[model samples]
Structure formats: structure tokens, C-alpha cells
Target: MNVADKNLARVGSDELAANSPDTRTRHGKLVSPVITLAHGGGGKAMRDLIDDVFIEAFSNPTLNTLEDQARFQLSDLARYGDRLAMTTDSYVIDPIFFPGGDIGKLAICGTVNDLAVGGATPLYLTCAMIIEEGMQVSTLRQIVKSMADTAKAAGVFIVTGDTKVVGRSSCDKIFINTAGIGVIHQDFKLGADKAQDGDHILVNGYLGDHGAAILNARGDMHLTSPIESDCAPLHELIQTLLTAAPNTRFIRDATRGGIASVLNEIAAASKCAIEIHETKTPIRQEVKGFCEILGLDPLYLANEGKLVAVVPANESQAALSAMRDHPLGKYSADIGSVLPGGRAGRVHMQTSFGGKRIVDMLVGEQLPRIC
Candidate 1:
């Protein structure tokens, strides 16, 4: 078997024993072995499916009530911070299961990172799923379990959800949508328009691993490598950076379109020019080779666990130190700087070959359905 297949096989073997057929019962009802149209018909089959798969895996007081909506106490939210931050994201990645993570884990981390980059402490999330009829019950159970573990690690709760089943052709095997709510401290203020001249640009670690891993997992190119998705929660890393450099001008997660698109957006919003040094940008050798072979630019490839920070020149060292000290930011680097307003709304890169080039927004989709 190829590397991607081998990796998936290993994951299945490791988890299948615990998730066998004998373990598929809840409330004295044996859950259906496979999803059918009846599971989405809003009747006993639907309730039983929800109870056995979702509610069972994500058990908490708020979610257990089985109410139409989840309610939160304002007083409890006020303890974390004064401002609230909320974000929602959908995951429709091909090959629902991939190296290092699956669609379920991606949904949680993507939403959590969105709130984190906005200077918020993520508190809760809502999960909604659209499943294709005929998908295996065992597959749904595995994905839901992965979501539960990721939510617990991020210190957030999944308190509400909705499930819909459609004809097999209407959707892929499954799709996940997650919305997150967080609280931000009154002292923290950040936005893309806040970037200023002389602000140093920093990235937490290597980029494009998630995109590369997903592409390889599809096996379209018949290629293989040890690259795994860099899918992870960045709230702690952001919190640490904020503590060390309170004057950080802006922070953004490098997701779709990678760091290139993020820099272009920041430049346009702030009316400033961003200049990055090619030599300083960190990229895995395997990803670089893969991109080279495919005629792809790593800069435009997506990343899940990376963030770009714009901090004042004076505080750059402190921010770098704080990032490097964290487990996720050990490979952090100051890749570039926000320059004066002469070339407003532009992103330029200093190529390693001693030349400069404009890094503009992508003209079209480089990879579609890549989450």
C-alpha cells in the first residue's frame, strides 16, 4: 500500500477495536448500522441516531437537555473578558479522513483559531452536520468522537447542533459546520486596518502542511510523503503572544490562500506595503519539493495551524521569544515587515535569488474543496 493508505489503515486498526458493533448501543436501542433517509425524517430513527452518535459522544449539561437552542449565562461569559468574538466555518474537505486529522477535527480547530486570532478566549461551539444517505454508521461515530476529543482539548464545549441527511448524490459522505463564541479582554485591540509602518511580520511555524497532506491523501498524483496536516488549536499560542507583546497591531490565521492572501488583505486594509524575505520564510523540505514538482507556489497553499502577527519593530524580539517558547511555535520566524505607505496596498517578496516580485491575490482557485 502507498503511504497515505498505510497511514489510514493504521489509524483504523488502532481505533476500530474500541468502536466495534458491540459498542453501538445507547438507551437500550441498537443504533442503525448505516445511515438512511429515515434518520433525517425527524422521527424516532433521527432521535435515536442523534442520541446514540452525537449526544452520547458530546455529553454536557447544556447539550444533554435536547433543547432547540443552547442558552448561555451572560454573567459566566463576563468572567473571561469584556468583548465577545464569534466565527463560523464549514468543512467539506475531500477524503473526510486524512493524515493527522479528519473533517471533524478541522471544523473545531478552524473555528477556534478564528476566535483566537481576534484576541478572544473561545468558550463554546455549535456543530451542524449534513450527511449523505448510505454513509456508514461506524464512520459517523468515529468523526463525532474525534470532534469531542478536539473540543475538550481546546477547552470549549459543543452545546448545540443540527443534523441533516440528504440523498447520496446531494452531498459528499459528510460535511461539518461549526460556529464558535469567545470573549476578548478589554485591553486587547487588533484588526487588519491597525497594521502600521515598521511593523514586523511573524509566522508561528511551517506553512502548507495541511493543504499538502490533503492533496496527497486524495492520491490523485500517486505521490506520497511523511507530511501530515498541521491542523491544531492556536488559542494558547495567541494568548502567549498577546501577553508578551500587548501592542501587536494585527493577527490572522493563514488558512485558505495561505499567508500570501492574508498579507495582501492586510496591506489593502491598512494601506501599507508588506515586504517578505524568501530566505526567512520557513517551509518543510518535503512540501517545497512537492510544490516544485506540481508547479505550485507554497505561499498560496492553505495552512490550518499557522498565524501571521504584525508587531511593532521594538516589540518584535519579545513576540518572537514568546512564540518560540511555545510547543507550536518552535519554528517561528520574522519573515517580513510592513513598510511605509509609499506603495500602499501591495505585497512584495525578496526572492532568494536577489530579486523582488509582487505577491498578488490568486487569480483563481488553486485547490478546491480543500476546507
Candidate 2:
């Protein structure tokens, strides 16, 4: 028997759903208005939800086979690189749907970027969903479609996945977890400890847009602005930058604690001092205004599509130029550099007012559940 047949074997639809007539059709699509516990009961109802939702959205030869695990040819993996890279992330952002992206997009971007920052080209992903029983099927379908579209755009595939339904109060609505695998070229190497003194620091584009957008989306402050989450895949941009500056020392997605946190981590790891110029930092004025009003510092805000790169001083120009040419990095800038002669893990910022201040680790979260 084929894998798809095996996945639905041992029980005919009539035998599996003797008590739940009319809940599904021949292809195992749910006709119910909303999700129910039976959808996760490992029977015809469960198969119906999978066929109607996940299998339909992420249809591919490997996934359509409905096997429990995704298989790959060893030669295909070796064709890309000498080493394998893998990363996993879960998305539990409070508001599932947001201005620039939803939970689905955030999950894909987060996992993909985690691999990209380490110089990996993402290939395959596994998705797992925990859906609330009372949630609308339409909402679930929408999120799945978003994930499939984003994966395709990023040049990756969702090859395997699992689904579950829980009590209405157990899960907020839906939460998604994604695990990705990628390959790193034989010659590629990257690490925070690899940062060298005199290396120039660069950022792809504006910071704090994702943080500001999420905060505004929650409606806690009751304010409005034109900010949207900067959630996006970074592998392509990273590849372009590497081609221009092959000696790049390190790259990190400025996610939860923002660039301030990334710099501190880099300094501590490399045992070097670093400094940044506020005048050169790229931040949207609206985000700055949002931070000012909330008594927050834009430096510590989260970012989904931003990264901190350390490139040798000689190649910084090439790196900046390459990033600027990419669709996602038109505002790329050289924000700072690793300072010389003080290797005590210190990071400082030169404010626009010509005053110097220490840039330290974020003590507490400025925002919670922000991917």
C-alpha cells in the first residue's frame, strides 16, 4: 500500500465515525462550522481536519504522500553543503493576526532566520499546530495558507506536520511550532566569538518596527500609527551579503532583545569593546515617537526582520552596498564598529547629542509574547 493509504489504513470512514455521521466527505473534509475535540481524536474526524486544512494548503509530492516522516536523498543534501543546520521555534504572539504578518508568518520567519544567521540555506520544515476547540475553521485555514505561501516564497517546504485540538481555555486560539533544516557551505563559518576588534557593524534596515507594530496592535495604548511588523526571511539577503563580503565575521537576527542585546552578546563572546553612533542608526521616526511616549528605548525593542552584522572594516562598504540593493534592505547602514584596545566586553553608544553612554543587556522584557 502507498504511504497515503497506510496513513488512513485499518479503519474505513464508516467504521471510524459511526457516531459522527455527516461530519466529513469522501476526501475527509470537515463540514462542521468550528473545530471540535473529535477533530483530534485520531479517527476519521482527525484525518478529515488534516486533509481539509494542512494537507490541502501545503500540498507537495513529499507531503502529499502522507508519510509519518519526510525522507530525503543523501546526494541531494550533500549537493548544498558539508554541514547540516537545524533550528526550531514556537509562535505564541498574543494577537495571532497583525499588521504586516500573522502567527503563521512569524513562525516561518523566526525558524528560517535562526538558520540563516548561522550561514545556512533552509530546505525543509516541520509544522505542528495546537488549535483551540472553539476556534473557527476559516481562521485556522487562513493561518495555514499564510504559512504555506511564506514557505514557498522563502524557497523552503513544509514536508511533515502534526495537528492537535485542545480545550477552548487551554490554548488562546492557536499556536504553531516549526522546525527547519538547512545546509551550510563547506567554507562558511560564523560565530559571536568570531567578532574582531575594528570590525564594522551593520544593520539591514529600520529597527523597532515589529515591536511598535505589535504593541500598537494590542490596543493597550489606544494609539495609531503606520507601523508594521518587519517579519521576513533573511537567508537570501544574508547570501547576497556573503557574496559581496565573504570574510564577514558574524550575523545575528535582532529579535527578542533587539540590537542592543545582540551587540552585548557579541562583545561578551568576542571579548571586545564595541561602540555605535546614534546618528547613523536606522529607525523609523514613528517608532521613535512610540518609544518616547512610552518611556521606552528604541534600542532594546524587538525586531523580526533586522540583523546585526560584523564585517571586516575593508569589506564593510561592499556589505552595505549589497544589502541596500536587496528588496528587504534598502535602508541598510553602517551603524557602529568594534572599538580597539579595551577587550572587557563593553558596548557603548554615541548619542546624537555627542554624549557617550553604556549599552547594556536588556534587564527585562519590554514587551511580552512577541514571537
Candidate 3:
């Protein structure tokens, strides 16, 4: 079997230990069949759990200190920029593991994206886990390793964290909280209110994949198709857009409330009218079918990898070219524009049928338990 398949099966069988250091007994392969309250009782079990599962996977000089806080020299921070950017988020997605990623990956990317949307250079992260009593130790190990792997790939460090365990049903299998730290150059400026008249709106890639993937993974509808969560880190893509379109006004990652919600916020904040064309929105064929069958609007669906960018009309082509060149933004498109001579604080989409309708704030989440 492939390495990924083997790791996925390791939670039920121990044979994969031959090729995996994570399966070794010293790294949290405990004698107990499942985790218990004692794992969080502040004793030897807790220490062993932290040392084996977390410290082993996220080994770094800063975290290795094992102190209450992580310290950095002011000079070290100044190397990247004159200002600092910070963001915190919690992931409580049900069924921690999904088609394209898990809660661990989501936690890391979600935290990093929050900072990156503002043109920050991501650097460090803090992971806090809340685990349930009956969770499998092997499963927890897999999750922690996923977090570590994602953080390393995103050029950030999981420097410190805390852990807690509760009753069997007190929480889901696991919940992760993360805080991200990054540096912002003094020249870079972006905000929700920065959008201006005649600005063009752009998206990194296809939207609504995460929500559809999570709903299908749950098997509540007794239906299935090849839909996977579009979970990814987009700091690199944002940097590329900023380089090409230095006059870009604002950027926002489309997450829980989806692109529709983000556009509404931008319009309201900028006090302008925004218009998007349905023909220009990039969406997968599978996602289109999934939404059509469920009477759902893809515009309001959640997305983990998509982002909205507002760029000036003169620089729109340059920004789109830069985004298309990036791996994460292979499907980038200019979908809309801020209307001129209007500050209605409204967002509307020009329909494929040649009409328009107001796209307002999502009153409530269409999908719950989504990161």
C-alpha cells in the first residue's frame, strides 16, 4: 500500500510501525486501547503524551524550551518587516479527517490564511488541542503529525501549545485552536474598507469545495461523488498577487460564510456597490451538480482554499496573470468590479440569464461544524 494509505490504516493495526517512526511505542503508541481522563490528569501519562505525540512531531528549538511562552529577539522580528501581524482561530470540524485534509491541516492553514490575507509573512504558530476521553492514541498521533507536516510546508513553526481531555462525549473526537504570528512590511497596506470604485474583484480558484466535501463525507444524504475539500495555505499566492498588483486594495479568504459573505463585508466597509458576473465565477462541475440537487447557492457555500481580491482596473490584468502563474491560483479569474458613481453599500451578481439580485450577508451558516 502507499505511504498515505498505510498511515490511515495504522490507527486500527500496528503493522505499519516498520516504516513509520510515529507508530513506535516511544512516540505515543500506548498500551491502553484508548485515551482516558488520566491522560490529562497532569501526571506521567500527560507528560508522556505531550513528549511523544506533540514534541516529537513538532520538534523545534523554540518549542523544545518547554516554557510557558515563546520568546523572540526584536531584531529577529525586524528582519522581515517593521510591523507584526497576529491571528487566532479554532477548528471544530466534525469527523476530524476529511477527503482532502483533516482538522489539523485546517487549523494550521486557517490560522496562517488569516494573517496572509493582510499581506503578512507567516512565521510561527501555537497549537492547542482539546481531545476527548475515548479518542484513539494512534488517531491523535496521525492528526498531530499532519499539523506538524503542514506547518513545516507552510514555512511556520508550531512553537508551543496546551492539551486537555474531557469526558467521552463532552466534545468531538478532537478540537484544535491555533494562533499565528507574522511580519508585515511597512509599505504593504490592505483592509476591507480599501476597495474603491472602478476596482476589479478576483478569486484565487474554485469556490464551495470544502462545504460540499464535508457534507458528503458525513454520509447524511446517502449520496456520493468525487468531491474533496479544497484545503490549502495561500500565503504564497497572496504574495504573488501583491507583487503584480501593488495597487491592490483588499483581500479576504472565503471561508465559513463563503465568497458571498466576504463580498458583502467588503461592499459595506468600502461603502460602494459591487457587481459580479455569474459566467465568470469559477466552480467545479461536480460542485455545481451537488448544489443544484440540494437547492443550495454555491455563492454562499464555504471554501477553505479560495480568496477574493480587489485590485484597481489598471492593474487587474497584471494581478490576474501573477495569480494564474502560482500553483494555488491556477484557476484565478476576474469575476467582478466595484461599480462607479455609486456607494450603495450593496453587492449584486449579474445572472447568466441577464438579470441581477442582491447578494447579502449570510444570515446563518449553511453548513455547521465547518472550520
Cα lDDT computed for each candidate against the true fold: 0.87, 0.86, 0.84
Residue pairs in collision within model 1: none
State the lDDT at 133 in candidate 2: 94
Tell me how far the alpha carbon of residue 193 in candidate 2 is from the true structure, in angstroms, after superposition: 0.5
Q: Per-residue lDDT tens digits of candidate 1, residues 28-131?
A: 24367899999989988998888888988987767776678777667666755688899999999998998989999999999999998998877779999999
Backbone clashes, each candidate: 0, 0, 0
lDDT score for candidate 3 against the true structure? 0.84
Worst 10 residues of 2 by lDDT: 9-18
Give me candidate 2's TM-score against the actual structure. Answer: 0.92
Q: Write the per-residue lDDT of candidate 3 for residues 190-233, one digit (tens) a residue.
A: 99998888999999889999999998899887676889999999
* Cα TM-score per model: 0.92, 0.92, 0.91
Q: For model 2, which pairs clash?
A: none
Clashing pairs in 3: none
